[model samples]
Target: MDLQQMRYVVAVAETASFTRAAEACHVVQSALSHQVARLEKELGARLFERTSRRVRLTTAGEAFLPAARQALEAAERARAEVAAATGEIRGRLTVGSIPTVAAVDLPSVIRTYRRRYPQVRFSLRAGSSERLVEQVRDGALDAAFLGVQPGFLPQGVRDREIGQGRHVAVMAPDHPLAARHEVDLRLMAGEVFVDFADGSAARAQSDQAFAALGLRREVAFEVSGVELMLRMVRQALGIALLPGAFGAELHGLRCVPITDGPVRVERLVWSRFPPTPAAAAFLALLDV
Candidate 1:
């Protein structure tokens, strides 16, 4: 019923642990748990299923978190609007990005934004593109920088294409294809490959390229984190196809361009609705 109670629920839902949520909200664990329990009693539904291992949202919590988040965001927007009307732009900007976005110079962007609006605070969250997109849609994140393919964007979200690059192959120096500047897809068909998880945009593009060539990939490992895949490739477990700008120029490995595949575009994505003042300001600088 209260904003604090709603915030408590959201924090628990996000962190999946009462102790961690209490830490995030800067409250004592006992008080946070008491408030959430009171709210559940008022609503007459179990919000979370708690186990010794983790907390999971029940059906009711899943149905309620989005609207609660929107209410919180709307309250923030109202406060920001009043402050902005006084010619002072100050508020929190929640931003999400993928690990591969290290190539996008986000740190420089944040530094520049801070110089312009020192009153604004930023909280940066890192995750996969899929998780970022989900957060943006639910208003848990104000905006995000994502790696996506053209025309596959999530609904109710807008994106600006900032820059783009393509996938490349990396292998040990002693690998047969190391001497070559580029490697053909067919040449590596027989080799065990390290690749992204099937749900990732990078994996989708790689899959399409293989399907087009009528070749089936021999996936030895499918990992969610590209860093782990790079490590696997470096250790000679298997070759990997990764973004050309992944910033992993292994001295012991040769990086080569994939002869065919769709280009990976880096986009600045946000909800289509009005955003927080800090997020708006940061987004404005994205085009500059």
Candidate 2:
């Protein structure tokens, strides 16, 4: 019924332990449990099933969780909007991005935002473009930077294309194709490739490209991090196809232009609903 009770319930659901939840909320376990118990009594339904070992949400708790989160977010947004009216922004801004984001210097942008709005807090997460977009849609992230194959757009979110570029083949300096000015997909068909994990948006870009050409390259190394992929390429374990700008600063590796490579489009996506004041201010900072 009250915000504090909702907060306690959410914390308990997240931590799955009343003791941990109390610690997170900076309250004593007995007080937090009393508040939750009062809330459950008011609703006439048990919210959690507690045992000596662990705590788990009941069916009613699961049904109430989403609305509880939305209510909390709405209250926070209202407070932030009132603060914004007084020429101040005070709220948490959660942003997500792909590892290879290059359209804007994220650290620099965050630094500027912090200087302009010191009262605002920030959280950053990195993942594949598809996952980032999904997080944005789910309200876990206020905004996200994503990279998808050309001619495709993420659904259920508002997006803006920031930049686009072609994929380049990265290889060890001593590799035979390293000296080539540009390499065709067909020429790389026989080479072992180091690619992003399967089903990831980064990997899909190259996969769709190769499939379109009716070619298949052996992906001997599948990695989630760019540094790992680069390391594998540096050791001549395999070559990789990555965004052109992503390989520009690497050392001891050759980035060959892929003449018929997949095109990657970088986009900034946000929730379709009205954004919180902090999120709006950050988007305005980017002139979006």
Candidate 3:
């Protein structure tokens, strides 16, 4: 069987639907099915069990899946290596980010990369740090800027850090303790807290800090994005501890440094997979 057939098998197995796999592969369903059938015939064993509702991998299919994935990755690495050797990098680079990054200083770096590698394409998606880590580990993303607690990242994943920013207390300007230049966790202990959702990287850091101080938070709101959390803070819904990066645009809110709060860290993380030519080129630009 060919690489296309292997790709078809992998896609079909992943999606569990011929139609969905065909759509993902940008091919008609009939052609995809025909190719899979031909592959099975040549192999002398069925790879999938199809029903009206869903498709599943047969035992042989399960056995063959890993090799198929390896073959595809190998082919990808080969293509990337050749492109790098030729000094021409042109491909889609899917990157993920958290909402708070919009407030961080990043425009110049992005603009410089764009100017240097005009041929490289970029696709950015916003998601929770936990989800972004999952995507990077699964090879669905080239890399992502993620908030992670120290020593908490999964095995085989590597990170390039963007400093551990000082944590600050965010709240309405008129809220109690807002007039202070700095606040400690002990002072905010009695107030309602608005925080990142459970299992998020930011939450992990906050939780570790609270646990260290032997304090428990009365989380009034748990949100997915920094914007919503800030909105809540502005309305006096609760106080939140966020990184100083958010200090730039307070809008109707105040961000006071938490003298002893958790350090907020962001990292650019990538999978153990060999980088694509475009991803490598982009990474090279980061060194500047």
Name the candidate that leads on TM-score: 2
TM-score of each: 0.80, 0.94, 0.80
lDDT of 1 by residue, 1-288 (tens): 999999999999988899999999999999999999999999999999998898999999999998889788778778888888898788888899987774478889889988998888888998878888888987778888888766666666887777777777888777788788877788888989888888687677777778888999798899988778878888888988767887354567788887774467787789888777777888888862
lDDT at position 145, candidate 1: 82
Residue 270 alpha-carbon offset, candidate 3, angstroms = 3.7
Residue 221 local lDDT, model 1 = 94
**lDDT of model 2, residue 164:** 93
User: Which prediction has the highest lDDT against the true structure?
Assistant: 2
Runs of candidate 3 with Cα error greater than 4 angstroms are: 102-108, 125-140, 150-154, 198-200, 271-274
lDDT of the candidates, in the order given: 0.83, 0.92, 0.81
Q: How far is candidate 2 from the true structure (C-alpha RMSD, Å)?
A: 1.6
Higher-scoring candidate on TM-score, 2 or 3: 2
Off by over 4 Å in 1: 5-68, 150-153, 247-251
lDDT of 2 by residue, 153-259 (tens): 89999999999999999999999999999999999999999998898888888999999999988999899899898888888999999888887977889999999
